[model samples]
Target: MPETPEIPDIPAQIPALREDPETEGTQDAAGTVSGEDGDRGTAEPEAEHGDAGFDLGEPGFDHSAPVVAESLVPESVRQVAARATLPFQAARADLSFGTAFWYNDLIETGGDHEVIRQYLVTATSRTLFEIGQWTLRGDLTDPEQPVDELVMGGFAKRWKVLEGLGVAVMPTVELHLHAERKGWRWDTQEITDGLAAQADDIAAIGAEPMPAYILGHEADDSGRSAHPDRTQRLLAGEVCRPAPDAPLTWSDPLPTGFDGAPVFAALPLPDEQLKLLCLGVALPGEGGPDAPATVVAFADLRPAIHALAPHRRRHWWQRG
Candidate 1:
């Protein structure tokens, strides 16, 4: 928020000077290609082939053009191929062929990929954060698009960032695999019902249904409690308790399905502001100085989320 400044205008055109003589091509210090000598047109007859085209050259090869393997490839392609052979970072950003359109347009020609990656990550993060901040402020262009809706929107944008980093969404599968690997099992029914309840609340807020699931650990040899104390813990309709300080406290004497699985459920928050509250004994994995312990804590909506309803008008760029 401190860095909020006027958005800079992005130039649609490349900065490089045009090679077309009819355009902006300039004659310098005696009118030669490299400023050497000779008839500029025939200084080196073969070099004319190079200077005869646009500085950036044509956009990729036209398949309709006649092809001899030698002629099949355009001069730009040959130059790009030579450059790509240097190293990935040294590759040209404006190869025209096989280049990512956004990368080609947004990134400068011959830009380093490592730099480009960092640029992309930063740009995308800033863009999403601004959108989130604006959405929370309810200053968005469309006032009818409620502030609460931004949570789902933010989630979607964040998911795109995760995907770009090659992260897969494996809520259920990840929990099962991790539990099995750590010698534990997931209480799916308990988790699913909790999420289903949250989904209903979110739907009531005019948000699309977002079914949630608990991705957590099972008991293991690391500690006796790491595993289920009894098979009944894995089943549904079992007693559900809350951490002493948690809000919206409730207990379910009966649960659904399995008996031995340690579980947690996603429960809805009040006032149509749906969120996951811890319902069962199992808690999320925590990183710690020593071995992390699974301790129950109250689950509440993020403070930013709760701040949505009343403060949205602050983000409105212009007031009616």
Candidate 2:
């Protein structure tokens, strides 16, 4: 077997969850990223092994908590956030990074629920940084009754696996950089132009080789760890086009409950499929229609979720 790359060490002092401005009306105070296995539906406690100090078992791993300006947020996250031109106030202006996860309500009732497991690194700041994965374990047949659930934690434990899967973080950074420099507002024309300009670089990054550790086939291996090769290919930026017979659907500013804000955008892959991108923006105060927007979360949508409208899809949490 080939030598494996050393996994990075996670900080023992996990940051405390901070109050995010965007979490108004939601369960922000109770929302936290914990290391408990039973709460997260995991069979074992993976955080004890020291793989970045994250307990992969819990679903409510708060990715959006504000990090102190002096705290150690990932350099990659900071760099990407700094380069991107955000349209709203940042949650933490000092040193911050954004996070995105599927809303819990949508995940339980929405199609392509697995898409929520992925992590997204948007621009950094404290303006709007409370992120979590939504979870619901109760009966799905009753839509009228409120279901008790947790919505955070999948990415915290699997950060290493994501890195190994060849998800290029830098390309996203570069895209933000390019867009900011060009003064491109989050409009269709501007987004299309920016994507066209960066097509070459995106393709180059997508073609890179995936790491070997991600090549195993086992379900209990850890949150969808089975079929490593397939996962590798999918995460390696391989474009998945809609079936030729599949009807094409298009919507301007897809209704993602972002109040017509251009929070989500997509680029046409070389294969004619769309590469969906979602931006989690942090609003200044209890965000209303007039609240100024700031981007906190950034992520690429999984192929299945990317093809559908935001309203049609299920997310981990719903905005109040």
Candidate 3:
């Protein structure tokens, strides 16, 4: 593994608040008196003597005075009430895969964890192209923890049988995580088995394969490519198939054209065709478009894909 770069200290500019013992039991702006134990008490009613007695309808009484109502409420309670009455506004919810502890482990380890996640995704796609946006570890960990260093990427089980075959097969879900923490270990088999179990549960239900779409430019007569309708069709879930006989290829580094385009097809994998394939030949890893073909499959592939779908869907929805 390559050496991970050093992580810089995160700045903490906010000053810490210190409680002052001398101010204990002091009266606050809200007429309530706070005790040392943190409990609050209302100020004693003004000595009820003769005409000075408290009365709701007293002509000279200022009914809206802070001392009359606000002082009886604790500041914290008042703040909460104010917030509750504020207009509703939607905020993005954190949607991340894997357990919270898993993310916490990455953040705590603090080095190479992010890189490891990305590298895993890149390595797994040795045979297929990765699609969709990479998930952020920060989304899963405590908000106070810095997750700028951790990331995860995913690959679809289905690939273009041969670049433009129209028909595709999805046999598994592939996810990769990258973090730069030293002294951390990964139990590959355990992780793989857990993913397989989830996939099996999904497969048992026989759910239909989810649609996948692609967005790219079509070349003109002069070989210049443009994205006139790619964005709309891709968003509409239009299947993007390669031209017949066109070189079937995908790039690890996304194309410069569509910034957020879907890079993989979302064709569903049929249950009957989900069998594992044992290749009789080894394909060249660095070969060009004409490299010899070698079929590959793993029994756990389909289940893994199912396990990864929900997380990916969350991101997809957010993007939409």
- Name the best candidate (by TM-score): 2
lDDT of 2 by residue, 1-320 (tens): 32211221112211222233221122223422333221121111111213334332222222222222222222312221222221111122231222221121112212211112111222222212233232221221122223222333322332211221122111111111222222331111111111111223223223222111000011122333211111100111112213332211111111111221223323444555443332232222224324333322223222222222233222457543
| Candidate numbers sorted by lDDT from highest down | 2, 3, 1
- lDDT comparing candidate 1 with the true structure: 0.20
Ranking by TM-score: 2, 3, 1
State the lDDT of candidate 3 residue by residue for 1-320, as single tens digits: 32222211111111122232222234332212222321111111111212223232321121111121222323322221111110000011211111110100011111211111101111123223232222222322222233222211222332223231222222111111011111121222111111111222223322232222222221122323221111112211211113332222232222222221212221123532221111011121245434322111112332332232212112345464
- Give the TM-scores of the predictions, in the order they appear: 0.18, 0.21, 0.19
Backbone clash numbers for all candidates listed? 26, 34, 29
How much lDDT does each candidate structure score?
0.20, 0.22, 0.20
RMSD of each: 26.5, 22.8, 26.2
Per-residue lDDT value at 141 in model 1: 16
Q: Tens digit of lDDT per residue, candidate 1, span 1-320?
A: 32211111112111222233221112322211111111111111011112323233222111011122322223322322211110001012221100000111111123211000000111121222211211111221122222221111221132122222111110111112222223332221111122212322322322222222222211222332311221111222222223333222112221211111122333333443323322222221233212212212112221111222122222356455
Worst 10 residues of 3 by lDDT: 96-105
Q: After superposition, how far is residue 195 of candidate 1 from its true place, in Å?
A: 4.4
